[model samples]
Target chain A: MARLSDVIEKFIKSLLEESEGELELQRNELADYFECAPSQINYVLATRFSVSHGYYIESRRGGGGYIRIVCLDVDKNNFLHYLVSEGIGSRITEHDALHIVQRLLEQNYIAPKSAGLIKSAITDKAIGIPSTLKDTIRANILKSMITAVMAWQGK
Target chain B: MARLSDVIEKFIKSLLEESEGELELQRNELADYFECAPSQINYVLATRFSVSHGYYIESRRGGGGYIRIVCLDVDKNNFLHYLVSEGIGSRITEHDALHIVQRLLEQNYIAPKSAGLIKSAITDKAIGIPSTLKDTIRANILKSMITAVMAWQGK
Candidate 1:
């Protein structure tokens, strides 16, 4: 049997396909259709539709309120600029670095195995330096890395 | 990833730093801090703190005897050879490769910007392949990159 989460994901994806990649769903109705709790619907939306996964969600509450989800287009040029300029400061946490790698994977800007390599390369443990200096060093490293990746892409 | 042995090794090393490159501790005290069996400490000492990683451990087991740890200076040539042979295998994950790079950076083998460029170029994503194939390619790439780095240093 398909897992409840999997089924829910597939159903929503099917809906998205029909709706041209944007959707506004009735929260309660989705729960009723899946025969699951409203929180389960919320869970699905939270995990599967995050910005890092190339989604934009805006939810409204009360009567006539809806859950809005948009399949965001991957803007590599804009993203590369942000990553180099403001996205990475002097030091980036491993979690945030991995998040960006995940985002790149979701957008097809980078491959999955490459994502794993990038994650490993940026970690505190990998850097093997004092905690205070890691982030600043990480920032410089990531900026140069992103620029290099862009140049490799002939951008 | 944070194995008990690895955690124990890090804790001991942290204490060594504060103690000016050497430390003495009760096995039971460390076991108590990590809430693991006392034997776990011995396991970590026997494995991770071996001479190859540039650590030395001595213990006199008894009521008053303490385990002592010391950080050893690395022999760059020997360390580099070990990294190429054992630290990286036919498949080098980004973690292992990056660890080597970080060590090189710390040892002044590569400059900070050069390290970043090296990381970007050697990543599996830059190579673009299936996960199963990536490690093999990464190993080849890392070895070549390291050789290039060494050559650059000599030049």
Candidate 2:
């Protein structure tokens, strides 16, 4: 059987697809439906629905609280430009970088080969340095590369 | 004044260009012409004309011997495969990796953007781990990325 997290991720994706890439739901209700803890729902959202994964998430607190998820819809050229300018900060973990690459792949902004190259470049195995400075360097390099490819559209 | 090494490199490249990418000359004579030691000639050849730099050098000893330089000529599809199989070994330094990326760009096997991405990935800044294991991991990642793009020809 698939892991609970995987199942939850799929269910949320289906809902987003059906709803045209935007959806709102009650966290407690989703937890109840999945028969999992509220924390579990949070875990899925945090891991599988982050902005780096081409998703924007918003939530409110109190009795009327709801979770809003928005699949990124942007001009293809601006997508990478936005990420370079705002999304990737000075430091980023391998996980977040991979998510960005996956998002690019899914959005058809890059080919499979390009995605493979990007993944190979960003992985911890390739970026083997001191832990303290690794994330910063990774972000810098990733931004530089993305910027290099930004001019590739319509050509 | 240009550095002696740079001047020598430029001179040799011109000669190669004129000769259609192959040259034969007496090492000692060239060293004398440059007013440098035979070792300097050797240094230039070792650094600037390495196989990773898309060059091959063969030197012979004794009075009748001459140095032979051959620029790599191969089908573009076979180039990366050849490197993955025989060129990049278990370990490679940042300098060598950069050289390989440069060669690929020069040969037009990859676009400038792709080259930028590859260079960013293989740099020490990106691969910031322990000293001992850095090169090995760098080699692995470079080969993997190259292999990923090998099938991209004519597509």
Candidate 3:
């Protein structure tokens, strides 16, 4: 049985996919359709549709309140630089890292084999340090590798 | 002035470089030349010239005993596969991982950019786990990435 959260996430993703990575949803309508509380919608947005997951969500609270979701666009020229300074920062979790990698793959910034290499390198299993330090190291490694790619690509 | 151990390491490396990665040395004689204890020579070999560092050492004991050091050769065809099964195994330290990357770079099996990416992926900073689990994860990641490279290269 699929969890409500998972189902909601999938539904929203499908909507985004269909709408070309941008969409607006009425929280009340979605809640009613799923027979769930609006809070469930909020939960889904906060967790599965967060910036870390390559999404930017804006919620308006009013009579006409709506949730606006936008997928982060990868600017071909500056994305690697952006990722180093902003996307990865100094710390990153495995989930967030994987999401970023997924986005890169989707954008065709890296080949499938390269994507696999990145995933293998950044996976939680590979970064087998104390929980406190894992994210920091993952960030460093990811940044360095991205820089390497940029150099290779002559960017 | 460089430390005795460093000097000895460099001297041996130069010898190997000159000899096409194979050399034989009598420990006592080298120690006398360096005006140091034989144990010091042993220290340099143990620390700087281990198999993990991409050099293999064989010691023959007795009057005719000699220390033979051979650099690990990367067989262009099956090296990546060999690394997954034999070289990387279940666990790997940063030092060992770096050495493998270096060997690949030297052998021209990977481009500089790909080398940079591989190094970044396997580095300790990237694998931010506990010391105990770090090596195992590093091994997994290195193996996976190598497999990725192999695929990309159509090997």
Candidate 4:
């Protein structure tokens, strides 16, 4: 038999896999199932499923209350292949794009030097436009270009 | 007479300028010089010099301990160029990959239509992969493709 926590973890993961927009659960019901304290469920949620870990959670109080989770799915392999087929088409934003680069750098998927270059290119102030639209356009263009390059490599 | 707080701020900034990496200081010693409470020094550090303000500070307490500060000269422009030269490989999901695209668009480094296409391409249905690997792959491919395109553009 699995530990209550492990079982709960797997249960949540399965729910995430099946759910479309979000996943929800009740603390008391879950506790009853595991024959453990409600706090244990909270602990698992806090540590195992977090935004940094690519999961989002929400909870409610009172009757019919439940906890909800959302998983952010981003594959690490074969991304290059997809981008190449996608093609570079428009502008991209500084903030939106930097997160992607940061994550890649964090995972050691790309070189630090490369991360720096991408940051500079995407956030270059000289691009010349209304400040509001700059980041948005930069992000689009970056996507298109990256996709194009990836597609070319695929050939 | 110069305000004690002013003196401390200048001292820290000077240390940042002279030091190659991070700077360290003692809270009690600084407090003693300023003729103020230790918390005052803490206040100065929190306000005047912060990681978000391009400086990182860390401290330890209990017998002969001190604070450490690091200044990060984040040259956004140069960093992007370096990123392009390096590479991102692997599969990634649409959401994470879009971040880079968005940043590039914001900075006016890329166009708009390109971003949309990339977004559409990286979506779950488009990539056809398990949720867990989507973001990771998206990040990797996004970087790789972008670097490749940037390289071609240079040539």
Compared with the true structure, all predictions reach lDDT values of 0.68, 0.79, 0.78, 0.58
lDDT by residue for model 1 over B35-137, one digit each (tens)?
Answer: 9998998888878876445565555654457887766544545555566546676777877777777888898866665566567755655544344655665
Worst 10 residues of 1 chain A by lDDT: A111-120
lDDT of 2 by residue, B1-155 (tens): 77999999999999999998779988888999999999998899888886556665655575467898876553655778688768898889999999999999999888887887788777777655546667876787787677556645344
* Number of clashing residue pairs, candidate 3: 7
Q: Candidate 4 lDDT (Cα, whole model)?
A: 0.58
Off by over 4 Å in 4: A1-78, A81-93, A123-130, A144-155, B2-9, B14-20, B23-155
Residue-level error in angstroms, candidate 1, position A142: 2.0
Ranking by lDDT: 2, 3, 1, 4
> Which residue runs of candidate 3 sit more than 4 Å off their true CA positions?
A129-133, A152-155, B1-81, B89-116, B119-140, B147-155
Estimate the TM-score for candidate 3: 0.54
- Tell me each candidate's i-RMS in Å: 14.3, 13.3, 13.4, 15.0
Judged by DockQ, which candidate is best?
3
Error of 4 at A79 (Å): 2.2
DockQ of 4: 0.05
What TM-score does candidate 1 get on C-alpha atoms?
0.50
Clashing pairs in 2: A127-B127, A128-B128, A128-B129, A129-B128, A129-B129
Task: Give a tens-digit lDDT track for model 4, residues B11-79.
Answer: 888877887646778888878877899999888888887533445555556555778876644454344
What is the C-alpha interface RMSD of model 4?
A: 15.0
Between candidates 2 and 3, the one scoring higher on lDDT is: 2
Chain B TM-score, candidates in order:
0.47, 0.53, 0.52, 0.49
Residues A1-155, model 2: lDDT tens digits: 24688789999999999999999999999899989999999999988888767789998999899999999887777778888898898889988898888888888888777786787667665555556566876687688668766866665
For each predicted model, how many residue pairs clash, with residues at least 3 apart or on different chains? Answer: 4, 5, 7, 104
Per-residue lDDT tens digits for candidate 3, residues A70-142, read 9998576598888987968889888789888887776788767667678767766655444667777778778
**Judged by DockQ relative to the true structure, which candidate is superior, 2 or 4?**
2
TM-score of 4: 0.33
Tell how far residue A124 is off in model 1, in angstroms.
2.7
